[model samples]
Target: MKTKFNYLIILLACLFFMACNQESKQLKQSQLPQNIDWEYQMAYQRGIEAVNWSIPAVSMICMRDANFGLGGSYNTVYWLSAPPTASIEALTANNQTPYASIFLNTKEGPVVLDIPPASDRTAIFGSAVDIWQEPVADIGPAGEDKGKGGKYVFLPPEYGGKEIEGCINVHVNSYQVFVALRCIPLGGASYKEAAEYSKNINAYSATKISNPPEGEYIDMAGKHLPTLPKYDDSYFKYIKELIDTEPLQERDMVMGGMLASIGIVKDKPFQPSEKVKKALKKAITDGYDYLEYMFETPGFSFIKQWDDRQWMAIREPSNDGFVFDEGDYLLIDDRGSLFHWATFFPRYLGKATAYLNAMKDADGNFLKGEKQYKLTVPAEVPARDFWSVIVYSKKTKAWIYSDTGRVGLSSYDKENMKLNDDGSVDIYFSKTAPEGMESNWIPTNGEDFFLLFRFYGPQESYFDKSFELPDVQILK
Candidate 1:
């Protein structure tokens, strides 16, 4: 009986030791740090929010800086003499039209933009935005002057200048403003003809309205202009410069406090400590990843224009002004997402044009660069002016460079491209051109890319959902 009791005691001791070991392992897995460093945590969180809020403004500054790098300054016009190519490193720039841009510094006084009336061969389509990238005036056929051209006077904040007769007055809250116009060819005119017509658009100070100085025009054809915002520590410096140069808006006071926490206060030098800098670096890089994640898994529903197709509107249809200003609050993530992949969003949406984006194929897979694909453009596209499809890198959001020197195939190329018996066209995308299909292929250069199908002067069928575009298919 004693021997049996000893064995029982030994078994009980072994069971207790095993139970203790399991409890210790669980405790180690759930261990907490001895203390929390709230400073780094707060800086990291606020820095992410600040980067999200500052992307649009930073993009504007980057464009202006790029122009300066190209030997052009404020009040100077830099226009592309042909369709944008890989040399033009802008975010989501179209390859079907020539672009004209100008940056005006209005700290001293107002700036006057003189737009010429639309001609039979060409017309301007674009908008002017403030330092905050808010549209102060849209100066194209559908803009302030309508089809007729006039002098647009952009008055600074709280300006007391007398209104000029027959002039469209735009009250702006910031001194730095940008004007970008697409010189579109009309009546099947060549892009070169549109480029020549763009020379008629000019800008001068309102002070010299009587005798305008000769405008400086810099043709940016074949020039390299890299204007994409960098996702790095230097981004904070641009924000600092912007704050120091422009007056703060009332709506941004709370955000300003957040900026202050990270050494971006107005009138104060931005020199963060090593600890803060480390936090900032982590915040911005990770924040960019987070933004990309949000794009992949969009919070907002994609507007499926066709029930059976996978093509979606490039942006949310209801987002007017690109500001995401809801009745009471702002849709911050939507605004950030739009600007992350594009620049030069206008004051209005889908009135003059419509853009559709296709990132996935019909079978619901992200576009693979190593694979081949095909898109079919039907005979009757619902566009009064024209339609185009351009491919951009999924990572850089810029043009894909290749030996062919082509980034898109559009309605403009239909005459040369092979068409089906029904008059529909098949455009291919891959690293190489298919046999006898060189004219209709856009090389992706082994990089994953997205498509922007634009319809200029969209017709009733487009808006009324009577027309539909087919989804891109794997070119097996």
Candidate 2:
């Protein structure tokens, strides 16, 4: 009987080990690629994905342009890495005072624009303006030169133009002389590859000016303007062809390839398809088209009208205005300043709530005044200038109540701030009055609210990951 019991136990142990081995085999089979074709496909797909994201980094630098007036002639230039120099010719002898703006796209950046400081008496020619990375913002010397003339200057790569890679120059002169420059880097396999990319972009911009794509015509006032020139249908056809040629991949190889190359993935399992690779490229190109349409086409007629106005009056001290539903998104040109406007489409329903959340976390919460909320800025808030907190009503989507009387924090004098003994600051958000806290109180009125934390001349604390804001907490 003892021998029989021992035999049964041995038999059970063998069965268990066999089951474990079979399970392990199945797991390996599921993870391992079945063939070499799959491996090559995977690598190719990975390469395509990298191209997609990198392509935009290049295109943004290419398509930038700025116009001083509606009838003003447009001047444009492309930037490359090398010695930077730009050509400047006074269109008219009287138009000696020139103004220029630079635009750039960057991976780690608040893309900046430099403005020459104005003359000492005029205070409008020789100053630097650093625009934020958001869709739009501008900075420049204080005050405007209504009459004192300034000359338009162009800085191309290799000249005194700001020493940066992938910068473009768009110079214009009219009622106001302006230059728009952008400094976004282009990634490529080699110098030759980078040069080729730049050439293609220049060609595309030229083509756009001569032969724009066809789309419905509308005016700046959101109305269909009469006698407007129609776009060519061939552009649409070209876009369609590009889309049809591109095919979606079964799996996203871009992420996989990056992981494998970086050693995050010990072994790649499956290969990607050629169709998938093409699709990824097409998607990125399509994104560029979308951006162009939003900025250039009548599809965004409202934006065009706002642009025509040259971003005037929008920043007026007494223009307490609000847009509801369709009016929620207001387009304004920062005029090379550090405060630009953007509209979140589709995903955010073009609502202020969406725009607010999309900003950096230090800007604060979109739902602050919804019920009740708390915002705390650490002693080490990042900025070279000064910082301030501002509140905007979600319903109005405009800055209504703020401690500093401005929409964002500024580098104002210390007497204007209400700080704690430890150098920490606490701000309150509510619609009703907080007793003895009026100085630090931000009125919300039970409506959704947006907050902007502006840092003037932001320091390394803002960029090097050392500065962080506490999560917004709902007190109620």
Candidate 3:
């Protein structure tokens, strides 16, 4: 009886080993796609994911190389002399407000962002985004400093220490973070006043005992600063730099592994053959089309305040603004769509701002200057401060320069706008404003235009998803 029992145990062990061998074979087969076409397709998709994930890093590289680059220095804030102009720069609905940008380096230690005060009308909103375009922290009124002044110390993900007192300690996802602040001219303060105040913001290593050097102010008023990346071979170099610099998150690691097949591995020099370059070029073009479709078409964005409203916040969970969903599963396509079509500004703020150029108006046609439209802002506007509408040329991605020197109309216009009955205000848009409605007019310059509606200090209505913005109605 003992010999028969031993035989049965041996047979079972042999069967188990056979099954394990078969499973291992199957796993290898699945991991190595069937054909060359399948392999190319997989690698191509991985390349797109890599580019989209690190676009912000490329922007920083561009700043470092271009005139807009603040002497190619990190841990320094560059306060633009004035708002962005058409000569250089491209983005959605950048208004005529003073802005400051800082590239913080936390590899050595935690970086500190010294913030200034934000009053009722004149407030500054600073948003910090990690190298992966993830929101690290926010400053100013809508953020930790809360309109008062204090130090915001941004710690890296690998930080090894207890919380430091007297600072807003932010554990970020990546070592390099970009903090862009917009100074809103509150009350009746002039643009120059808000701009000069933006100079007060500073960034330095928290390890420093002595005062960090004061931020250098660059007069970007009439200068040509190129902050967008060039779509060529050099772009991949920036991508490699981003990979080597920041510790990859889990999702980033998965993509990074795949990128090795295409020669983008860390410590491994990128030497793409002519064929590889051709493949990558086509892949990037397709990737851009996919990203544009993410915004122009429908997939990742969700209606924020109102069901029918065109104002859409990104579809990522409201709690975590920049991180994409699917956690471990990692919807790479979702991440690519998110940052490709959107930005990281105002990422962690209480106030909600929407990029409105995608598709507005009841008709859903591209906004053209040839047509006349009206945006009916309801009573109160549901803002703690105020709201404004600015026009941007789709071609330049900058404020449309006009002889009138007017790019937008704020609720804080020198003279209050004429409101209709029931306290609603009607802001108009066209190549030419109606004689009586000039105060509410935003000139389109007879070119394709985009619009951004900013709800500064948004109230409960916006958070509760109760407030709604009316469609841009085109009048005959």
Candidate 4:
């Protein structure tokens, strides 16, 4: 009878153990999504920066109270000089030559764009950028005009135009549009003259009044050109500000909902709870990992001619749309990935200096301005207009400021680069100019920098990989 009692007690213990196991599993299942929220937030954070990258570069103009607009507190038109410095407002990674720029708030009406005639060497282009910084229309060289400049009337979305129809008509995808003009002084035009002609690029209310006020120019020389906002916790603030000011498109509604779940909503205040912020911090880690992989993938890079070369280019467009049937088939992931990695302006192969920035030397090591290096351009370079090698700060993403006040050696510099016996050119980057190769030498000022190899009006050879540029070979 005692033995029978012992067996009953053992069975009861087994039952209790099984029940506890089941209860633990149920709890884990209930908490799974909450625990995985970190992964969700990372993807969410990247999307915010990728989509609204250009806002800070433009909005800072207003935030600075630049006193720019005609007869008002803000001046929409800002003129930048050739070879943009760190100080130029709204700076980009590959900002070469003089620039005439404006931010259009067409909530009022369509803004008319007027362009001066293009000289042979003056590579003037006006790009109409939406709030997303996507190119709505690129007017000027390599545009519909083929450098024969004309007046372009920019119409806002859902517009029934009430303005004159004599000029070329282009449409803006969003109401909050920013236009930037790049003019490289060519055919012997004076720098001052080129700067003044850029001012001719103007925008004013198209329908509000006949002959809307002419655009006033503010010299952007030596002024701090704002770069796009950083990708971080503060990135959310820029996203909120943009959504608040600009009209949101229908496709973005889904993302807007996701954002609101994290306390980011248009017209509503953003108030993220501590739990959300904690999840987001971890999400940021995962987000950067995802972005880092994109740089390695071939889809994001088009220059895949040589397997061993680290120099790759974002040579093609990632067709992005949220909905597949309506043709946003490629969508946000890859598009956002590229935008975060580089400062991009939408255009074709040969418009503004097409660039390939190298963070690594030829040996696949990080490029250090502390070390001396040599890059050999073998005989023939594939370019229609010109090609050059420029040094830039790896940290600032701006042109590295040097004692010479010169940034890079251009084929058009008239300084005359020394070519090899086989017609190849060797460009050197060092803290000081090499013995006799002063023109070919780009100073790093002992500062760690990267190289931006630009082929303005790139030729077929660049696409075909026939004219291969040698890697940055370490000299010392």
Candidate 5:
């Protein structure tokens, strides 16, 4: 009997071993591939994801480099002499006001931005942001100082320095910071006057506070500052520099790991393998087109400003002003699409401005530059300050240059524009002026274009939907 029991136990043991061996074989079979082809595919996917994830950072770096190309460096201010023309190759740059750009590096220590007090003639309108384009402080009247203009000191992530008195201290997680302030001409201020007022803004290291050097302001107007990110392997290079320079966010640790997989490790020199580069080359182009598609076909009603009108709001509802940090999951598509077409987002969208984008006309067709259209600006626009309609090339998101050098129409141009009996204005848009409508026409340069309707100091009516702007109508 004992011998029979022993034999049965041995048989059971043999069956268990066989089952374990079979499971092990299946697991090994299901293991991921490690061949060159597999590596290429994985890298390509990672690259695409990386591009979408890092669009803001890449754009910031491109702006930094663009400023560098224009002989503007860290702690230097680059203010436009006039409203930007096609010469300013930035995405959706406003032609309504002159711009001021400053790049600050806090790697050494804290940096200071001395914002001049807002005057009735002109006020600075912009915010300071980290490399991730997260706002550290808003510069002008709508910002932290409430237009009382003072020194905005930006400190590094691990900054242990004592807070300086009489300074608005902003703690930044990244070392590289950028400030894009608009010198808005107001109360009959000329564009050049506004540009000159921006010169009062100063930037220097906090260590030099006792004897701050004279702030250098460069007039970058009419210069080609190519601030657009290229859709190529160079995209990787831009993001690589960003990754190396800035501290990784805690929320992006997993993404950081993924980037490391594709030879974008922080503090490590990036020399991608030939296969990886080939993968990234294709991935970058595809990724860029994907963002363009996302912009055109948003596929969500949340992007729409008014259900009746085709015009879309440039910003989506977010606790973090479209930075996508508050949500449990990242809003990748929204962030990617926004920064793809525009730059310099604010920390919190203030009622001071409202921007509505129009790509399609009333019938839901894309606006063709060759076609003629008219936008009826109502007599009572919900803009306490002013309103403007700027036209930009769909291909580049930059100004469309034509013989007239007219890229937009604003309330300030009311005297020149043709007005109707009800006090509303009719603005024409076509490749050429519609005969008598030259003064009211915005030339599209025969390219597919989009419209940005900006409301400076947007009134409560604009927010409550009581005053809805009419859609662009095709003029036969």
Candidate 6:
């Protein structure tokens, strides 16, 4: 009876251990899929948000700092919001022509006018001015040429005192003008309150200018110009769905990893559930490995090889191979005289890589799949130097499809192209030559791809909504 009881006890203990092992396995498996899904969604969302936030944040910084914007030619415009007690007496003696309008609020009433010293005419006007050949215009005459010669209208304290709450409209052209509004509190107004009012006016002005959708620009090869993606209701809905479905712990882990990738957090102790911690480790490891692989990959090797000097050709003419790079079929020096300084050169290349990376399709293909496109370059595409269209493979970091034995299409090689009877050009993109169209073929390797439209010297058509490029469609 004693031996039989011992055997029963051992059997029960074995059964209990087996049951516990099964439960452990089940729990791990259940958590894994959810963790992975959450990781992917969270990482992608962070990347998208980073790009979105960068635009407004960079613009605001540029506006605040005179060291940036339009090659640093117009920093004084940002100083117009100074305190009321700040002396304009010194300003008047500087021989500075206050083309910008100033609004002042005093205890008695408001004042507004174009300030004095009227000899030096320099303000935030959009266009370039030929100040050498033509004499600077007076306030009355300058107002007429406001938008023409890039002469902006000034608002001064003599015209409107501290109580003013209105804008000065300076005509940029016959059809278009910008309004600079000033909102100031009455006399003995708190500086804090006045500052808040100024901020409100600035916000209002920004909203007005940002309206009116700027049409997308396309290249002759059918690639869209890099622009901010439209944020729509669908995008917000997608974000909401991701947040609701993903576990909070998993989301935090993913976000933390992404932040680490951008050097936001170098070393920090992070403790979460074992599963969440594992997922975070896997994501960081995988992302870095993939990027490393890409650097060594056939088409993407350029990213690893090209230095800042090589990329400078996209902005300035450096003897450091920018103008005479082997891959560049044509070089256009559209940079104006003001941009000749090296200190300001880096600004132009600021968003080039980020813009290229953002050109991806829904399927995670950067620029792959069969694509059909139509583009129109109107007669006399204006540029200071030249314009060219270049196609790049995100997978290869090189031009995907081209018979030119080059990466770019330039005006210098105009004679080499088979132009249509009407002086237009037609180019084809594919992995193989499409039947009879061998000469115009751009070679692809059946991977993701993108294209860049480099306008060495862009004219008004590039900025104005007049010239439009056709949309690209997936053929297959």
Worst 10 residues of 6 by lDDT: 89-98
Cα misplacement distance, residue 226 of candidate 4 (Å): 3.0
Tens-digit lDDT string for candidate 4 (270-336): 7777766666555554555665565446565334545678676654653331111235543355455
Give me the overall lDDT of model 6: 0.32
Which has the higher lDDT value, candidate number 1 or candidate number 5? 5
Model 4, CA-based lDDT: 0.63
Candidate 2 lDDT (Cα, whole model)? 0.32
Residue 339 displacement (Å), model 5 = 1.0
TM-score of each: 0.90, 0.32, 0.80, 0.79, 0.91, 0.30
> Cα deviation of 237 in candidate 4 (Å)?
1.2
Q: On a 0 to 100 scale, what is the lDDT of residue 394 in model 2? A: 36
Q: Residues 414-447, candidate 3, lDDT per residue (tens digit)?
A: 2567888887888888888878998888888788
Q: Which segments of model 3 are wrong by more than 4 Å?
A: 1-43, 59-72, 81-83, 88-90, 119-122, 161-165, 230-234, 308-319, 346-349, 352-358, 393-405, 414-426, 431-439, 463-467
Ten contiguous residues with the weakest lDDT in model 5: 297-306
The candidate with the higher lDDT, 1 or 3, is 1
Per-residue alpha-carbon lDDT of candidate 5 for residues 384-423, written as tens digits (9 for 90 to 100): 8889999999988888878777889999999987899999
**Candidate 3: TM-score?**
0.80
Whole-model lDDT values for every prediction: 0.85, 0.32, 0.69, 0.63, 0.86, 0.32
lDDT of 3: 0.69
Clashes of each: 0, 54, 3, 14, 0, 32
Query: In terms of lDDT, which candidate is stronger, 3 or 5?
Result: 5
| Best lDDT among the predictions, by candidate number | 5
- Residue-level lDDT tens digits of model 2 in 1-476: 99999999999999999999999999999998666564445444443333332222121211122112212222222223331111111110000111222232221222223223323322221222111111211222321322232222322212332423332233211111222322211221332232222221111122233353322111111111121111122222222222232221223244434634422232233233455445434544543344433322222212211222111111211123221112343222121111112211111111111011211123332364546655666776665434655555433334453333323332242345578798776666666645675555566656565554544345664444355555555566
Across 14-35, the per-residue lDDT of candidate 1 in tens digits comes to 9999999999998997796646
